[model samples]
Target: MNRSACLIFNPVAGQGDSEQDLAMIRAILEPEIDLDIQLTTEEISAEELAHEAVRRGVDTIIASGGDGTLSAVAAAVVSTDISLGIISRGTANAFATALGIPDTIDAACQVILQGVTRTVDAADCNGHRMVLLVGIGFEAEAVERADREAKNRFGVLAYILAGLQELRNLHSFDVEIETEDKIIKTSAVAVTVANAAPPSSVLAQGPGGIIVDDGLLDLTIVASLTRAGAIAAAFHLFQTASAGNGAERNDIGYLRAKQFKITTEPPQKIVVDGEILGTTPVEIRCIPAGLKIFVPSREEEEAVEKLEGLPNLTIEEKPSPENSPD
Candidate 1:
């Protein structure tokens, strides 16, 4: 492992004083990494701190907060060569889960010590660079509601509560999705533009959805009214999966593509990771392997094991400098 490093720590995250864990992490990493701790007080602090670390020639930048912090730091390293390390200390460590990085600080630090790095796809949501996935429609609204209370005593349950609340008032919106080869217009409740699979939510559980290295983004769109209706729609979707063809329900539209341009009648709120960004008329594209991230042993091992099972699988790495909209 390289000796030069930068640790961007969010003191406000986790159950209590993250500094206590930060101190312990520093102690563990001190022998192998040069730990420069930067405490984050605001959202913009992550990019500024990351840019500074890159300018100082730090070989690796450790994102020590939750998914939002990780996304911000990742945006700063879009075109840079520095590798990212994850310490999952936020309410929902989605990116951490997605990357197969351990939830424990000590376990993540150990992976850092091992010095394994893998390049993964990133997406440009309008101009903002995203590390995890982007949520649209009801999910975005859920994120906004969750954000209000998730900062306090609320945990992941806050998101669940907000989601159910959003579900109670759910209404499909008229929207158009423009892809390279098709234009689909539909009324949908929620849409997720994902760079990595299973999202951060499912990945925390050891095994999950699509491989991050697949070079394609997964767009999961839900176009339903009631909560039970949405659950039924998912089951219908799996039937199409077995046929190796995607299904577009009268209410639900789910598909995967590389680039998409979306326009809604009334601009819908967009959430990147957990933070809500601005609204629709957004252009999104996958920048293959735009950032190098640490993948935990389980994800890495699973990825290798799955590759052997695929008789028709294609793997490619895109190291080109990612371009974000102005």
Candidate 2:
């Protein structure tokens, strides 16, 4: 049951004690596996470290940071046999939360040690990697407003405050969404293309729960809404994500596609996996079963099974000695 892994730890990810976090991770994971710790720095990025691990043929690459760090590390491990693990040290920790991975260092490491993994879909957006949802328009504005200083001071409240301020100045723009079988042109305020998202990501919950292993992306578009309407729409989508209900409102549109071409009037800011990457007029395509991740098995994740009407975990084969690299 021995394995070798590279722990790509981001020291400045969340407002937590990184030294303690690092020590805890080493204490828990080192005893079980041959853990090689790599701290992310300004000079050395998480992505670069992950690539090094992959190049060295490490059996697994575990990311210990927020969703951004996880996404960056995952980008390198995608399509490879290496299993990815998350330690959930980000403010949102959205990807880890979505997969029901424990946020605590001990629990998260235990999940990795347990070795129950699944291959989930990832996406390529304009050549960048996407492990979580891509948000445009309203969501982008909010994410852009919540800078590192604001997040360090306010934690998750930073995002909420930014969103509340943005809701008052809502504007609609032209959108032409094209897929393999259909092209729909509409006007909207915000659009979300999600591969995996938690219930908190209300706008991405088009079909209630996002099925991560389905080899498709969920798209949710919201038309221009007044402040009140936006709040109501968010509540509606929350209900949809929580109760497995429909959008129920006409203003909200939902779709599923393997590839999507989106063109907007004025280029809107794009936030991919919590980082504001670029403006839109972007093309995104799903990479099915591209990344394997460590997660709790169905029997082990029972506590979260009925919590939010979330879909079932896409269980894949556990890693074996045969699959481990030299």
Candidate 3:
């Protein structure tokens, strides 16, 4: 029995040769599955194409682009039995990086052919379907600074440079956050609410790691800091995301909830899934097991783990890093 799939390819996603990527995807996937190729145009979006695929009753819908493309296609098929497949080919590729999906076209296509499926959490951010985190304040500012032209010129380094620049002007603002059980007030430079985030998305790694299938959103807030303190805090967060090493830092706040309503004193900017979506007084709600996706088998994951020899870092509090690293 062969699986029927629709491939929604974005030709202008990353700064790569779209022709070669498409050729590789078709060569690898078409042999194992009945593939329908859909080239996305400027007029018709990936989400629209995915809905069309759903109407045709394809067994799988595969998206070949960045996080935006994957999220759009996922939105069209959430809670349905149709398993979504990803062929990551975009700047950052953060969603794929978070899920342990290989970004290479060949490896991604092979994962789809393997036919293993995993169901994960998703979210609704002010009625927009969200498959990733929503960033407010510092992270949002950094995102804005890394404009399309800058990102195209410098790749991932653009984000790093923007983050460094934003650090200089970091300032705290008051926030009122409302959850189901409680209402809290605080002042912070940054706030992140995440359904899923890669390790490199340090701002969203509040509880050590973001569990995409956990049916809860991880919320992190960076408490008020001066220019120098903010730089140290940023380094601290990088440590947390990379090595799980920032637990003793009281300046950073962390929690988990099913929903959150966040309001800022000065009306902070918001970025969802890499797109700037204007100021915040935003609400986010988690949907449990809302997405089904193709992933590598457990055996494959274990094999990769053995090959990589990754360090096992747990969520234990390290010494307060106010002066630890600069």
List clash counts for every candidate, in order: 1, 0, 0
Ranking 1 against 2 by TM-score, winner: 2
User: What would the C-alpha RMSD of candidate 1 be, to one decimal place?
Assistant: 10.2
Cα displacement (Å) at residue 194, model 2: 0.4
Model 2 stretches astray by more than 4 angstroms: 303-326
lDDT tens digits, residue span 1-326, model 2: 66888989999999989999999998888887888889999999999999999999988899999888988999999889999999999888788988789988888999998999988999999999888889989999999988889889998888989999988779888999999899999998999999999887877886788889999999999884587888888888998778887687888999999989999998898999888988989899999999999998778887654545558745577789999888
Tens-digit lDDT string for candidate 1 (183-277):
98877777777776433242111112455776777777777778788656656655555454556467655566888888887789988867788
Task: Give the Å error, residue 211, model 1.
Answer: 2.7
Better model by TM-score: candidate 2 vs candidate 3: 2
TM agreement with the true structure for every prediction: 0.83, 0.91, 0.90
For candidate 1, the TM-score is 0.83
Query: For model 2, how many clashes?
Result: 0
Candidate 3's C-alpha runs over 4 A off are 303-326
Model 3, 241: alpha-carbon shift in Å?
2.9
Query: Candidate 1, overall lDDT?
Result: 0.75
Q: Give the per-residue lDDT digits (tens) of candidate 3, residues 168-188.
A: 878889999999999989999
What lDDT does each candidate get?
0.75, 0.89, 0.87
